[model samples]
Structure formats: C-alpha cells, structure tokens
Target: MDDLPIIELPEPYRIDEAQLTDQAALPQLMEQRMDAALQQIEQKASLRTDRHIQIMRENMHKYVEDRFQEAIRGSDDNALALVRGELKIRRADHHDSIARSEARVVELVRGILNQYDSATRVRQE
Candidate 1:
C-alpha cells in the first residue's frame, strides 16, 4: 500500500454568491417535494383500498350464489320426498282395491256353488 503514488486532491466545494441567493428558494422546493410525496402515498393507499373493496364484493356475491343454490337443492329434495310419499299412498290404495275385488269374486263363486247344489237336490227328490 505504501508503494502507491500520492494522488492530488481537488479543491474543497464552495457555494458562490448566486448559489447562496438560490438558498432563499429552498423552503418552497422542500414544500413542493413534500406535497408530491404525500400525493403519491395517498394514491397508493386509494388503489389498495379499491382492490380490497372489489375482493369483498366478489366474496359477497359468491356467498349469495352459494346460498341460493343450497336453497334450490333443499326445495328439490322436499319436492322429491313429497312425490315419493304420494306414490306410496297411491300404491297402498291400489293394493286395497285389488284385495276387495278378490274377496268379492270369492263370495260370488260360493253363492253360485250353493245354488247349483240346491237345484241338484231338488231334481233328485
């Protein structure tokens, strides 16, 4: 490190008369920069808020749709149950009617047999 040649240093920085007068405008420049920074921050915050609101709206819409679908499914289930019950009742009624018809046929056959037996006995006598 000591073998390196020495480098000449440049003169120190000095503010000239014109530059010193420009210092009077420093407060205005600072204020403008602060306002611009605040505006950018507010714009970013507004964008985030808008995105959050949109996400919430979408979730709410999906929730409502899901509930609607559930309600429709429940209604369909109830309707199916009602139809099944009605079919069961109708089947029972049909069975009862068939049983009554069979009983009547048996009674009619017995009555016919009785008439035939009585006629035969009278004819023999």
Candidate 2:
C-alpha cells in the first residue's frame, strides 16, 4: 500500500475481583446512605412550620375547652393532672425560634391571603 496512514490499536479494558466485590457492595452501601439521608430529611421536616403552630394553638385551645368542660363535670383530678403535665412537657419542648419563624410566615401568608381576598371582593363588587 502506497502512502497509507498508520493507526494504533487501543488497549483492552480489565476488570479486577476487588472492583467486582466493591460493585456488589454498592447497593447495600447506597441503601445505608439513603436511609441516613431520609432520617435527616425527616428530622428537618419535623421542624415547626406555620401550619404546625396553628395546629398547636388550636390543639391547646381545644385542650383548655375540654378541661373546662371536665371541670364543670367534676371529672377525675388525676386524669386532668396527667393531661396538664403532658401539655406542659410539650410546651417546654417547643422550639421558640421555630415558633417565631412560623409566626412570621403566618403573618406573611395572612397578608397575601388578605390581598387576594380584597382583590376578589373588589372584582366581585
């Protein structure tokens, strides 16, 4: 062949047993990592939000109403004390920063809702 261009062959790929073993362990490793990640996500999601504050306030109010009713009915003091204790513990465990942030979010959302409500009212008018 006259004036032919020369081409070099590429090297062949190789696989090792250690690499294969590592590859086999990958799924289990990934699962453990994913579980940790999910736990972290759950913890973060469990942080108080505006809705949580609203719910807590509503629940506290309901508890007070129920306790009032119970008092009127002359219900067991021990049961009332237990409930009060549980509520106290929950309140003590409450994150003030989260609550404050939630309050701010509530105010912002309320303002937005009010704006939308006013706009709709005006449109209807």
Which of the numbered candidates is closest to the native, going by highest lDDT?
Answer: 1
Q: What's each prediction's TM-score?
A: 0.69, 0.33
Residue 114 CA displacement from its true place in model 1, Å: 5.1
> Each model's C-alpha lDDT?
0.94, 0.87
Residues 1-125 of candidate 2 have per-residue lDDT tens digits of 87889765564445678889999999999999999999988877777565698899999999999989888767667778889999888886687757888999999999999999999999999
Clashing pairs in 1: none
Which residue pairs come into collision in candidate 2?
none
Candidate 2 local Cα displacement, residue 83, angstroms = 40
**Any idea how many clashes model 2 has?**
0
